[model samples]
Target: MYQPEEIRILIVDDEPSILKFLSLGLRNEGYQVMTAEDGLSGVNAAQEFEPHIVILDVMMPGMDGYEVCKLLKDIGNVAIIMLTAKDEVEDRVKGLNLGADDYMSKPFSFQELLARIQARIRNQFPHMMGDVQVGPFRIDDRRKEIRYEQRVLSLSATEYELLKYMVVNHGLVLSKATILDKVWGYDFGGQENIVEVYVRSIREKLEDREHQLIRTIRGAGYRVDLP
Candidate 1:
């Protein structure tokens, strides 16, 4: 089991209260916690602190979360959880599209936030560490890479996790709630529609190659059919 003290978390928010509150809670949980007031500082802290996870606020004064997410992604291998005050789908989608591992709307419970952080960390270290071949899809868990029909897929961490889960459970219809619990972690506290957004994104990439592995069972959820 991984210890909380082994994990370092960086919290980036413009609000002083949020920073103090989250920092205190995370520290109490035994995680090494760091904070930054804005996106630029967040980027700097990411480089300096080398945290395993980052809690980033979306609506900052300058250099919003989307841009910050992109920059951090370029820095590589760190998990990001984007925070947004609005419940707009576009904002969430934008964050995910920019490679954020997850999103939490403002006024979120610290318990749920902690759960998300733990879930993301759990995903980083899977019990299985090799490649999985299911139908036309090949998943390299160690490298965090996926290939379909001899072509590589450019997937965000969340998208890769969702696809890998579906592939592992191929031929079974997985409900949105189950996917959320398994892929996004339990009690994610976000709308189930976020699953649809990621599914569509994966479909657009996979189906564009004229290969359709994921099947939608209307009113049920989704399944990846074996080729």
Candidate 2:
């Protein structure tokens, strides 16, 4: 998974205030952020920065967001979120039709924008987002690591795989057979009891002594439930 610092975001808006506001807020969130005053500069920045996400404004003087979005899509696989002063359905549809991944109206809540950014990354560019946040866990597949509440957990290679599998499939009840097949491979010659042992070890590391996070589903196997 990619860390926030590893993820690049480009903010393109003619408005100075919006640019400053977004740049500061996104940088505070730890992303590598760049700003562009208009659509043309935004495209230039996208080419140089190769940002994973772009927050683009629709009404620009020279090129406008639709054209820029189209060009960006042609250039690379970027997740583009369009910002428009008008909240009309037609504007939203136009942006989407031009390959914008998401749309936001002006005066939008910063928190809501942040949520949309995370959602786009989760849905569209999962592999590029670095450390992805699934519930309370931050999974970094690249480093083969997991962090709970910002603290990195010490885990072995197999332990990491088991925990990552459980966390990725957080709500489902994973049976021993399924876990073994997915994590240990289908041809592994281990008994089902092995899943239980690893689960206990992972729970200890997670400090889930009360069995709150990872729970035993009786006749079923184990499930990871985030509080």
Best by lDDT: 2
Off by over 4 Å in 2: 129-227
Q: What digit string (tens of lDDT, one per residue) describes model 2 on residues 85-144?
A: 998999998997788877888889999898778766654565675677898889886687
- By TM-score, how accurate is candidate 1? 0.61
After the best TM-score superposition of candidate 2, give how far the Cα of residue 209 lies from its true spot, in angstroms. Answer: 31
lDDT of 1: 0.85
Full-model lDDT for every candidate: 0.85, 0.88
- For model 1 the local lDDT of residue 34 reads 96
TM values, all candidates:
0.61, 0.59
| Candidate 1 residue-wise lDDT, 1-227, digit = tens | 45788888999999999999999999999999999999999999999999889999999998988899999999978889999899999888788778898889988999989877865775554432356566787778878888999899999999999988887667668889879987898758999999999998998988734434787889999888776
Q: Which pairs clash inside model 1? A: none
